[model samples]
Target: MPSEPNTYPGYRFPAEVIHHATWLYHLFRLSLRDIELILAERGVVVSHESIRRWCLRFGTDFAAKLRKRRPKPDDTWHMDEVYLKINGELFYLWRAVDQHGVVLDILVQERRNAAAAKRFFKCRLAGLKYEPRRIVTDGLRSYGVAQREVLPGVQHRTSRYLNNRAENSHRLTRRRERQMQRFKSPEQAQRFLSAHAMIYGHFRPRQHLITADQYRRSRNKAFRTWWQETCVPMLA
Candidate 1:
């Protein structure tokens, strides 16, 4: 078999460095500067600027690979929007998650109108490559319109509690945003959150719902599958 092509263009960091950078950014919840400091303590010197670029560039790539290695959720979807700060301005982040609490898609938009809702629906649905049997959302007219226009026949339900799954899904994102202080722009927020969602989806196990031993074993199996199907092939 042919060797997998490298992702870096014209410049390459060691594979170990790439792995460490990806792991620390997600696992330790460290910012780029913190990651730089942590690596420096281990005898690796890298600029924070480079670390930031790596997180933005390679982080997304790694997350994509991780997503491909995971099983797609066939359960119903819950969609919702939450207010977020970007450049001191309030923007909206449209998020969708499956019943299993797996993040399906996230889109950051300036408005919460029908047009914005349609865009979010298109982007999220396209990424998942599946039309869900049911979609639950809050009492938003725009959501109704978007559902009619895009999903058409898909079962659409509007209820306060029906959207709790999606509302709770946003909490992890809010926590990450707080850790970063705040995003400087909408583009930055979109890029970082999109990658963060996939990383969280990969490492997180249902600890509250499952035993610690089960969680550990599940996480290890997930990691091994991810490394084999994503890393060994894509980064070989």
Candidate 2:
């Protein structure tokens, strides 16, 4: 028999199986039952409940590892806040992405006021080693208010049209939100989206900007990084 991964030593399933289910759930947006069906087709019988548990335990840790290994984000940040309908109540999801569309951080909050924006800015900034050179956001007024205090001296550009990089970042998020049938609460939204953004973005290079050959090479490297972070004894 093949060896099980050291990284997942205590689990009944091997790291490969657990990681596969995780990738399917996060990277492919497949539900737990869908992953179960796929695995069963290949003669591995595991319940969706087990897969769900596996994801909850291991997926976020893997993403955090991946996030640490990523190069520092570019200096220009594009930030935005989107309305989330959680539990039939309105909430705000604040997000920041670098010019390359690499997600910086995400925050779920009860409002989009200046205080809420400051909280988001501070939280996002706390994770980074460096501050942004500039930030572009919609003309929310709150962002401007936050910038004066939390991000003083950084070049702030407020325009509805100039923030397409940040706005376009929400497309996948919107899709995932729909698939999950909307988040149940602010905590749930914050916890799941933070992991989901990192995992999904790690695999998805900007394919449109690169040649097909280049895209393949970039993808191969990303998968290698994924394995190095999640698998023990490494994958050749």
Candidate 3:
């Protein structure tokens, strides 16, 4: 593929360095200083602050490109919400994933009420551009209310056991939450989680469902897509 246009204009660092640093920060649960130390060992002198800036600036762009390349989500959707403590204030994080474990959308809201549920449904459905065949969730009454208003005709299933896919998706976020000592604000949590989901979704295929060779091919393809999405454009 031909190179893409310069995405980091006027920055002293090359796109490769910036991209690598950003990737490390998101793809792994590493702190900015950890990334700084890793880069320093490789003979590249850079400050943690600079790495933070690069991530804040370019991470969303990379994620948007990755999402643009994803196939439309499956017809069956799983939705769930988890609690988040931001500055000691409790918040709800609503998340939706397809049957294949692909994240459809996420929202950090102040309540887990019917309105919050409706808003999440509206946001996710608007982005997907198509109605799902079935919606699955736990025994949350808010989900029923939202489904009735937004997706009245779609099949709605409520079973905690069946909704494991969506619930399991929160594991990474929980780990990252602990690592970062919890988010300072809802906006920060939303931005970081939104980008994290896309980047994580791109790289994480269904490992248990595929053979070793298939897994390797899938990972390689994901890496190639990442390189094309983040790196190739710079050369243009």
- Considering every candidate listed, which one attains the maximal TM-score? 2
Q: Which candidate comes out best when scored by lDDT?
A: 3
Candidate 3 regions off by >4 Å?
1-7, 233-236
> Could you tally the backbone clashes for each prediction?
0, 0, 3
Model 3 sits at a Cα RMSD from the real structure of: 2.9
Off by over 4 Å in 1: 1-9, 127-129, 229-236
Q: What is the TM-score of each candidate against the true structure?
A: 0.87, 0.94, 0.93
lDDT of 3 by residue, 67-105 (tens): 899988789999999999988889999999999788879
**Candidate 3, overall lDDT?**
0.90
Q: Model 1, range 1-236, lDDT digits (tens) per residue? A: 96554444544666557666876787666778888988899888889888777777677888888777778786689999999988778999999888877788899999999999999999977866678899999998999999999999899999999789899988888788889898889998888888888886788865787988899898887777656533444333
All-Cα superposition RMSD per candidate: 3.8, 1.6, 2.9
Task: Kindly indicate the candidate among 2 and 3 with the higher lDDT.
Answer: 3
Per-residue alpha-carbon lDDT of model 2 for 42-113, expressed as tens digits?
888999999989888887899899989888888999999899998889998899999888887999999999
Q: Once superposed on the true structure, which residue ranges of model 2 sit more than 4 Å away at CA? A: 1-9, 232-234
